[model samples]
Target: MQKLSNLIGLPVLETVTGTQIGMVEEVLLDIDQAVICGVLIDSENWFFKAYGIGFEDLFSIGRDAIMVRGSEVIKDLADLSALSSIYRLQDLTSKQIFTETGFLLGILMDVVFDVITGEIRAYQVSDSIITDLLYGRQTMPLPQAQVIGPDKVIVPDTMAKLLHAEQIL
Candidate 1:
């Protein structure tokens, strides 16, 4: 799967019409599903904006292109503003994880998403086996997984407790 950051600057192309719509400014987060919801775009045609095209008409697009089953392209420019208000993946990385017993686990390092559903599948810890193989022992994996906000990812209390006890190993 591609990292959310990779899509940040990639041009959003309309596969159906082969039109270059715009570049992705930010990815909207679906808090309910703990996954990416859509891409926010910047459609500032200088002349159009000068003639009073609103910002809302320039910034939002649907996730249809990212969906494997969808064929529809986002055509409405008015809905673009809604994307700016949605939570982003960057927001989730800032939250802390705590166990039911109130132990502090590590921060969220990454989110694993299912390609088919575009839903979050698991939490990847920085110090876990994968991270150890990639980075080294100064890191330890923490257990906590939940969505706190559009950008806030929280670790579940139950998992936090298990991790606190070192039972995850």
Candidate 2:
């Protein structure tokens, strides 16, 4: 498992030529499906357009970098329809998370996902900055049902009872 936020700024490498194509700028996710759609690669050049690589096109996701089979897998974000409608990871942060019964739980902090399968396993949430600094963020398993709206995320009410606060040392 990997935290989606950690992927940001990691190099995107082309395996065939061992060239560094770009850095991971953002992770694109299908919120309703709770799966990563792909990533946006920053070419770091004003003359170049950023590219998108679907999760399926990745050769491997390593601790140090993300590898692609070759430059062929990289394409203009406009051309990658699978990522067209997805939300960037950064866009979800600070969005209020609520229970089905309308109880305010917290806000989205991060996502724990399977690096190999791109499946979202859990969500790290923060009630407030003070709570986060004292108890750390709470981690909750992906609920059976989730609704992502323009301004908030709603999960099953049972999630309120299941959230586990991370121990801060």
Candidate 3:
């Protein structure tokens, strides 16, 4: 399982010309559908801002860098402007987790996913405690999200523990 944080700042390389394009600034996700679509390539150019590319354009996502087929696959359109309003991976942190039966679980710490498929595999729930660094915090694996909303995330009651954040280790 790979954490979403690992993709940040990874370099993007074009395979056709074998040229370095830029680094991955953030992973673009489809929140409602709960799928990672692509990445926003970091750029320093004044005229050209972030270069966005979809997963279909990717040759491979590797340990070293993100590989693309060519420059043509990159998108610089304004269509993605509204994506900023959508919830991102960063927003998941500290978001309350609610059960389908209406119960608060804990703060979401990290998400685990399949590297090849870009599917969210499991959630690592935590207490957000500094002492958790030394002693392990109680965790519950949320296999999938039932609903992702502006203020909170809902997972099936069966998947997560009933304990609250303050109750966990």
Candidate 4:
């Protein structure tokens, strides 16, 4: 698994032409599915609209760059219906996390995802920015989000032990 945040800023390369087209600006995440649907590419020109590549259209994600079969894989953001109106990684990061039973876990930090499938496997959380800087964050297996609202996310109550145990460890 790879951290989704790591993909940001990676160049998007067209394999057939051996040309660099754009860089990853952000990721479109389907929160309900716990998977990344596509990526938003940074437009090289200020006046040009940014584009996106659906997960299925990507050729591969490498250590240094993201590869696409060709430039045809890129499309206007509006053309990517599956990704056009979904939650983004930025939308969820820093959102508060709570248990179904109303216990506060921490703040959402980053997610570990399957590089090939885009499936979210785990979450990194921090009690606070201060604590995070001092002691580091905790990584917990995601049991699926029970609730995702504008400002907060709720996870299964069972995750409480998982998170707390990791803290003790």
Which candidate has the highest TM-score of all? 2
**Tens-place lDDT digits, model 4, residues 38-88:** 899987553456478989898998878999989888877654434534777
- Which candidate wins on lDDT? 2
Candidate 4 TM-score versus the reference: 0.84
Those runs of model 4 whose alpha carbons end farther than 4 Å from true positions after fitting are: 45-50, 79-85, 129-135, 164-169
Error of 2 at 13 (Å): 0.9
Residue 149, candidate 1: C-alpha displacement in angstroms: 7.0
lDDT of 2 at 75: 73
Model 2 clash pairs? Answer: none
Model 4, residue pairs in steric clash: none
* Model 3 TM-score on a 0 to 1 scale: 0.74
Give lDDT tens digits, candidate 2, residues 24-116. Answer: 989888766878889988875545554789899998999899999897887776554345457888887778999988999999888889988
Cα lDDT tens digits for candidate 1, 31-63 = 554556655555565333212122223233234
Which of candidates 2 and 4 reaches a greater lDDT?
A: 2
Better of 1 and 4 by TM-score: 4
Ranking by TM-score: 2, 4, 3, 1
Ten contiguous residues with the weakest lDDT in model 2: 76-85
